[model samples]
Target: MAGVRDPGALTSGQRTVMAATITASALLFSSLTSISVALPVIQRDLGISSSALHWVIVAALLPLCALAVVSGRLGDVLGRRRVFLAGILCFGAGSVVCAIAPDEVLLVAGRGIQGVGVALAVPLALANLTSALPGHRRGWAIGVLSAVTTGVSVVVPPSVAILVHFASWRWLFVAFVPVTVYVFLAGSRHIAESPRAPGASMDVRGCLFIAGGLTLLVFAFERSSDWGFTNRQTLAPLAAGLLLLVAFARAERRATDPLLDLRPLVRSGVSVPLTALAFAQCAVIVVTVYVTLYLQQVLDLGTIETGLLMLPTSVGSVLLGPVVGRLTDRGAGHHLVLGGMTLLTVALLWLAVGVDHRHGALLVPALFLLGLAVPLVYPSAGALSLGALPASARGVAASLQIEARQIGATMGLALMSALFTAVEWDERNARLADPAEHFTADEENKLDTVLTEAEKGQALLARLPPAERRKVHDAADAAFSTALNTTLIAAAGLLFLGVLLALGVFHVPRRGRRRPGP
Candidate 1:
């Protein structure tokens, strides 16, 4: 504990550790969305085909989500500090690779390397921060970390747009190299080493199973929207993923030092929180995806306006974070989580009812409620899940948290995609059935694909008479609105399920009593 300092006054060493870890967290999470904003620029610069553009996203996300658990266990077996430094190195190297990449292949490979680094760093950062603080202060610190990372996302889309507009897209990757180096140096100096499990060996078989399982699952979900869920490509991977995951569960039970200790899921009562996290994340992702699409396609908002409209959620979360953290520290984690879940459900319901081809700003109140709701549940649920485990297991516990949220996001994307696609297809068929429309098969097919794209849809209808075109445009808008409302209702239902799960797992401590730490 060379750099260790007492928690009182939060010494410079402690401050450095917090600053470094929090900065790393912000950078990593920013990558999740920023690359997407830069995708168009990347495609034009690298001559990347439209089909291959998605791989840019999948390349980074697949490894990040797949290897997260293994990375956490690695930190435990080796030293967290060692793994943390390694992560910084990998991410910095990958960013350098991306900046210089001349083709799509190298760019994608660089992204994959970055994913590996994220998988390594994110959980360890959390573990390190949790270890740095005394039990009483961990919740508040976590809240601040969560707040900054989530709040920064509000600015990321617009920032990336500005950066891409003013300079080369490659600069996006290059600009962060200095920050990465700083974090690495500062972390090496200030972040204390945590307990390395003596005699613990790497769970090689478990790692392979989980990495393969999760990668396949995430791949299947990401592709499901395009491949169709029932298509052989999707079903085959889905089955394989499920089988591999089952095998992983069996292997962990037998391993001397499992990569993931399932007992904690039940013993620490973390299963409930994990379940809540998953369902809550599902709802959150659905809102994010559909709401953005709704704003653009239905309400006819520009990219800048859409990004600006999304700010309420970020602002609400930032403002409410400290209060929620204080309440959680006061043994109100359970109540906060339940209340948050309830509010989330209500917000979703409001969005569902209010969705229309009207002013986009009307959604602001619900979005802000969503922002407030998220901070309450996310940090509290995280504390409830990780705080219940011993320090030695916190890394693995953090990995579990990350994995749950990622899986939830993947599932949400797939679910909403399927629902929305089905509605689109149904709407297309209904239009085709109308004899008065007199649509040809080719025209119907073109309309089917572009129903969600206002520009494309208008172009496709350009050959038609103005009256017919207007009718079709209005119909497409209505269909898109219906799809959005359906997804919102579905998200609301998922949040209700999360509320019930939270109720089962958490209980407020009596007045003047604090919940016991692990």
Candidate 2:
């Protein structure tokens, strides 16, 4: 291993550390979401069967979610710079594997490798920024950093479409090569090692238990879309995963070197801020998922068209981010968070009421507003989550906060899906009951499929009598629209709840000398 080169001097102080860390984190986070937009083309090129598509996308995410805490803990115990560099190396290597893979299996394997890399790097990146920057600038720095992280959600989707169109889909992975290399070389040289607890040791057993449990938990959430929640496939893994997680929590209390300091896990200070941010995150991700669907499936737009429509959100994020950060820096963190989350709540409610087949343009302002809101809430929330922590606790706090966000997004997806399914079922059954319409189980499945894939659906519907076909099509649209509406309302309610929590519960970190002696 490269001995720590004059990293303190290399950083050139906080300004360079801030710039390098933000750039590195953006690339890492963007890589996580970029694959989604390119998946269809990837599916076609790899001859990936429809059944395997989920795995292709989930491959990287699984490790990313599962290993997050473990990576953060390792950073705390060892040195942040060393662990951070190792992550860059792993991410770079994984990108190479992904770019060169010749078949579906190898591609999925490569993705998993990339996920591991992200897990290791992401938590430490923010922790470095927090520890490096001075106190007053901390919130602003974290907010701007959070803005960059959140921008990935708005930016990656549209960007991927353009890249895939002009260049091969492989270039998506290839593109990461130079960026990852630069971060590895420059970040390793510049970023300083964070303060480590003397004689701090890792809880290897606890890490294994947590890692195992998290992997299973993510698997359950990932598979729930395909395998219904009631199915044994979903229930069995979920039950076992929760049990293992419980065991991990118990282990943390007793272990000498706990993966997470158990005190914060139970404290209102940590839980409340984390809970509030998680809900807001849940709201934003659902917007990304369902809004894209409404534009494509409902408005009947193509991939490139949908991509273009979504560009305003990214533009808004880039333009508005620094302002939010500045506001937070001026000790307006709470107000900005409240205002930002309120915008999210309003945007979602607007989406619920206003979205229809003809009004794709209405989405532009709502999405821009959504993008604008993210900076307000997340950076402030991140600052709140980590600001008062001892250097070592910052890693656990950072990773745990990340894990909460991922879990929130997972839960939100499952909640929306269940609600959508229930609403769709009732609406569809009401239509199917008409005696003149005779859709068999097969025909019913085909009709549902058409909502997502219009061209193939239209061909199948042509086999039906023209009069019956139009009713069926319109009913399908109505059912989908209703389900989407209800889901948005639910998302809005969750965000509002987060707003309340942020107002009432998120207090500044308490000062203390709590680290155990060497």
Candidate 3:
């Protein structure tokens, strides 16, 4: 091998290296979905308030959003393999702490640690993958990684549901212990060292500015629903974050070796795909959260069944993984992205209409199409992201791409939350305005307020007559469906925008395209 900096000079077997990296990648991705299944169990066991329980989820997300860019850059300076190993160590340690924590506070704190580890590892793994594999194989490798994650999501929930049903939420953390340990030990041997900038000075000020800015920015987005948008608590942090980010941009332009170089983002190859992926990801995340709610709350499906009902989401990744990857390898990355976005937009619109119409069958097919479309976008986009950067800058490229998607996820969740609250308020207000419903003043007052999950559950409706209970149930479900549909429509629009951006990203002429040989 010529040197460590040469990506074409990976020293280990590709399969073994990919196994290790993808295992670490899968571990982080699985954590995102499986935890939701155990949240209710955790709340009951820890005696945490319903409203406060959101902090547990936010605690994890906050660090992932805040530290992602810095961590990626750190990998470039320090070494991707070194960062990956350290991340696994942190993640394993955090899981143990989470498993043993006696209260919600400690558990949430443990998750914050885990999130830091995740922020460190995820991008480095992809960077390593894009580096180790040949250009043609990179897309296929990304496809396999995507499929592995989808497979993990499919397996984790029902299994966690069963574990939570029979045992404690603590066991959920225990499940990952052996697997992570195996990955760490084996990965030490298989993963190769990547190109790194040992002489580049760390951008400490840039790091601080970005970390503070993104943290506050995400904080403001999360709190905006509770505190009005115009509230000082919301607006002050947001404005300050914007200013810090502006300063950060200026600092990047002036830095000797910048934390984040803005120049790579100018190319259509990089800018278009990454930007489009962000909105596409926004649609997926919002849909997943709402659909899970729809299945459990609207359809009253049990935990295991709800998990099963959502299983079709994996099929797309399985089927599209090879095709999209090959297409990307063949210089059709942008074209595939356009197709994926179109599919997702249709899926979102389908779900919106079917959900509002209260037809359960339609949701299944829509989710299937979503499964198909999502994999197409990811592999193509991830390949393009790596293509946009030099081997030394892969870490930065991967992290920035993930960070864009992270921002999209945050914004999507916030938008849906606000929309749901508003629609629920309208539902409640309608009862006060209705004369024929004949709800008493006390009943109308209670109905006029936005209801919590517990308030909407069996206890509240138990005392009502059968007819009144049925009416209440129907109204609640209808209001939820309408709100969800509105969110879906908005998500569809986001995907449509993505389609346009993706087309621009892949604007190369077919005749000029270069293809790898057998």
Candidate 4:
């Protein structure tokens, strides 16, 4: 077996490989996030239902969540380079499919394929980096990876939105094709292939259970507004998904070589950091999705303006990441993690309380603070998670962390969407004069049209009389403010939970040495 290299003392060739891997990872992360700002346009062009629109943005996350552990095991059994290359191919192919997808169904299928590729790429990338680099160098490499991944999400999505303004939404997927091709070609030569461990088997059944469970759960949550939570269409899938997840847990516990080893999750070393990562990711997704909408819808900003507004997040992450990484390497993981989480919580609360139509300026500082907090939190969480495991299980551990991130993102979007929809509904209802006592049929029709028609919703107030317009504007503002606050408060709570989880799960005695490498 090839041994792990000392990251701190990497030869020039190894350093080159690390740089290439980080670049590849960054490209992939940028591709994943670049779609965020384009989502509204996609929804309009595709004529997709609200539920379908949600899936379009989040579908990639589902397979990533389900396949992560399995992909990690594949990395160990099939060789990391082979899996990594295959992932690149898959991602590129999926992008092509998305670029030409004729309808929502085809687009979603393409997105799911992309999710699989992400599942394969992300964990293998991390596993390869962790295995190739030595101690302090590993921390630094991971820091760079975290910074690039998180930073790109903040920067690239809005930039893509700017492109979408001048070009079609199809260009968003088209843009990735060249980058993917370049990364695949360049990385193939630079990265060494690790030999597969003999006698390892893929747990096909475990993969099925997890995939089915997550898909069902995600679908249920995505469609809850349309189908209603109590409807069989929603409840059945959700219940079945939960049952399958429970079955997956049972199967993993009993399997001789489980695809997803549940043992590590039970171990304090692994579980703590993983949970914190999951929660933090949830907060990030919620903030990202809503903030983009807030800029475009509430602030009436164009794509270019929105893109520029989001730049602070990326700038802050780039600045803070390396510093936090150094601190973690110097034995301050707990402090950095705690401080980052606290910053994130404060930012979310500030946004919730202070954000309004005239308060667009507040977004600048809030986003920048979040930018700073994310890099600090993510890299430390990743390093701590990987640090808890033996070398042999690093692939699985990395996959587990990625899976947590995916699940958190999916759940966060679903929850925030539900809140937004509910608030919007209430706002519409509030605008209706006492319907039980003196409502006109035209007023009821207008309200229904606002709720049902996406384009109509935007112009509803514009078409009303001046007196009525004031009422509609006030109601819309109230609704948006309420929804934004609710989501931000929820985000803040999640961040606080993340901090507590980190404190409990990631706590290592100051005098303790690193666990012996597997």
Give the candidate number with the greatest TM-score.
4
Candidate 1's C-alpha lDDT? 0.73
Q: Please, what is the whole-model Cα lDDT of each candidate in the order they appear?
A: 0.73, 0.71, 0.72, 0.73
Instruction: Write one digit per residue (lDDT tens) for candidate 4, span 401-516.
Output: 77788888887777677766666556656665533123444333334223223554445545566666556555655665677778788889888987877676555544575574
TM-score of 3: 0.78
Give lDDT tens digits, candidate 1, residues 274-353: 77787777777667656765665567665556666766666656687778778888867778778888998999888877
Clashing pairs in 4: 6-134, 7-134, 391-518
lDDT of 3 by residue, 1-518 (tens): 45446555444577777887888898786785567656655654665533345456556666666567777678778888888888888888888989999987899888888888888887788887777777878888887887788788778777877787778778888877776787678768777777788674678998888778876776676566557678999899899989998998899889887777766677666778777777877787677666766766677665676666677776677677777778898867767778888998999999988888777788889889888888888889888777666677676677678767776665556555665545654564454243315555444434411222454244445656666766666666676677788878887887787777666546663456443221
TM-score of candidate 2 to 2 decimals: 0.75
Candidate 2 or 1, higher lDDT: 1
Give the backbone clash total of model 1. Answer: 0
Model 4 Cα shift for residue 362 (angstroms): 1.6
Model 2 deviation from native, Cα RMSD in Å: 6.5
